[model samples]
Target chain A: MKFSPLVDELIKSLQCLPGVGPRSAQRMAFHLLERDRNGGGKLGDSVSRAMSEVGHCQQCRTFTEQELCQICSNPKRTESGQLCVVESPADLLAIESAGQYSGQYFVLMGHLSPLDGIGPDDIGLDRLETTLSEGEWREIILATNPTVEGEATAQYIADIAHDCDVKVTRIAHGVPVGGELEYVDGTTLALSFSGRTAV
Target chain B: MKFSPLVDELIKSLQCLPGVGPRSAQRMAFHLLERDRNGGGKLGDSVSRAMSEVGHCQQCRTFTEQELCQICSNPKRTESGQLCVVESPADLLAIESAGQYSGQYFVLMGHLSPLDGIGPDDIGLDRLETTLSEGEWREIILATNPTVEGEATAQYIADIAHDCDVKVTRIAHGVPVGGELEYVDGTTLALSFSGRTAV
Candidate 1:
């Protein structure tokens, strides 16, 4: 579809969002232009403000305006001395929404991918090591995904925690909450059965 | 997930986009804060600039920074004296991308919805009447959607065009390209069969 240069640029810029495609971007651009200029203005201003103000937290590497994120800075959260290591801020937010985890978090920013040139230091693994050594953590939860890279990263961090005499635990992997057993994949079914607990 | 006030506001503001819910908004917010600050900044600036600069064309009611849209202002396009009336700017873009039509367009911005308090005047039908009266046109193409409201609007506009002794045509609605007859809905199948033409 043909758009003015300004509208064209806006549509292209919107594609940076995950899962948004060219058609969806066009729809968003027209929506902003036609019905919701006020909403568009607010979105623009908020995005700019967030981009400029947000930065990595000093302790956990999560996005925050201050040096430490809300979770890292809060004394109540730190009292648990239980830390969860995650692959990204989105994962951290997911755990937070579950409302079960009371401990603090350490975000890896990304999983290790040697082919992609991301190694030990690239995802702040060295910082993670230092944090493990310094903190008096009773246990460390490796909440990374169950992909091959996630497993490798978890193992590497587990070795580091072992060296520091800290306990390391991996979050369980199994069939998803709503998945039917018949429709579940073989690997997930096996993992769910093997990781089964007493009823 | 609990976010700082600024982050929360940004996520909330992002929900104005069509099909984006709270989860997608949160993901978008975190993405901007983490990986795509530059894109976020650019989108914000572009949205504001478009909102402030873009306005409806005086003649056709389509969006443009100038008093008249590119199509309306172009001397070559106006000479055809063929006007295509559409529901919104998106529909105009879709037709323009097809590159078959050389005529100009008039955007209604919305369909007539009586329950929602929208009427003929609300969608600039009066302005359309004025434009039709002033212009020397061969035909008026009613390019609104094929829904009930669309048919009503097209009939209403056709009545007006009839008064002006202007020929009115409705865009054909039939089986879509690549549509399988077995899978086609009853209404669409009926419409396609009824609108059939001899080869």
Candidate 2:
């Protein structure tokens, strides 16, 4: 009636991934069994090792197997005296890929959502405050997502940064580059108008 | 600039799954590392175990950890004197889910593809021939997909079954039961008309 017990278990366990459902899980399991056994074995080992070994970097709260993440440990990154606060490691990577900012980052791991009972300390804001106070940073950039929770998180961290005598700035919100104004949402259009430059 | 070595490797390894690209791989890796380490660990163990232990069923060629799959091992399944041939385990599962077929199955694992150099043996047709010649089936049902290669494969197997002195039947091709006539493609519509059964 169903796949063998081990196959069924593999399919079920694969559903734990984000956006994967029963059908996708089945396809993935079959794909591994039928086509790419070597890749599957490697995936299994890598996932196991990463799960057991990877931990949060003590300095920036980003994922790493070491005491500090690569970016956090780099002295050149600290010389910029600018700290970018992001909700997750993915967000940090997005900013890093832009190749514009060379400052250090502090990963929140998640934004504050009081309705869900998540508070500042839950997102590692206390640690952010400690870093802001101890480090000779000239500016703290709030680079969290533009969502309500991300905004609230940024504001809370901004207040903490102000108390630590660091100038706080939020990333500018506006129409994305190469975006057509006609297709832009009302809220984003309004923000673009309000935040427009003199040029 | 990049994730830690372990994290990077996890992301890359995760991409081995079908339909997963770089972005999805990164998301999966981070999700496992951040929120579902327990699930990730379980998935790792399950995948590893399945890859190492699961092998083709000696009788039906479906994936199994045992010499014979459940259906092949069941005495009652052989009572119908019918064997359904399908392209993959997923197809077998689909037919089984319909609850209409109690007959045994022969999983081809893939259809015949000459351009890609996949011969009959590559899809285990040689094994299928052995089964067809040895089993006491009154009829062999060809349930391969309606695609070009699948149809060719079904035709080839039908010939083999005929040579083995067993009656062969192909599952009827037509518009799907719930699909709208206007939305159905020309080939399916034509098949539906041609394959219509009189009340």
Candidate number of the best lDDT:
2
Instruction: Write the residue-wise lDDT of candidate 2 on B52-167 in tens digits.
Output: 99999998999999899999999999999999999999999999999999999999999999999999999988988889898788899999999999999999998888899999
User: Worst 10-residue stretch by lDDT in candidate 2 chain A?
Assistant: A126-135
Which prediction has the highest TM-score against the true structure? 2
Off by over 4 Å in 1: A174-199, B177-199
Query: What DockQ results do all the predictions give, each relative to the true complex?
Result: 0.64, 0.88
lDDT of 1 by residue, A1-199 (tens): 3566677788899998888999999899889998899999899888888888877888999877788888888899989999999998889888998999999999999998999999989889899899989989999999998999999999999999999999999999898887798998899899999999998
DockQ of 1: 0.64
Which pairs in model 1 have colliding backbones? Answer: none
The C-alpha RMSD of each candidate to the native structure, in angstroms, is 2.4, 1.5
TM-score of each: 0.92, 0.96
Residue B50 in model 2: lDDT: 94
Instruction: For candidate 1, write residues B1-199 as lDDT tens digits.
Output: 5776678888999999999999999888877777788888898888888878888889888887778877887899988889999998888988998889999898999888899999999999999999899889999999999999998889999999999889999888888999888898999889888989899
What TM-score number comes out for model 1?
0.92
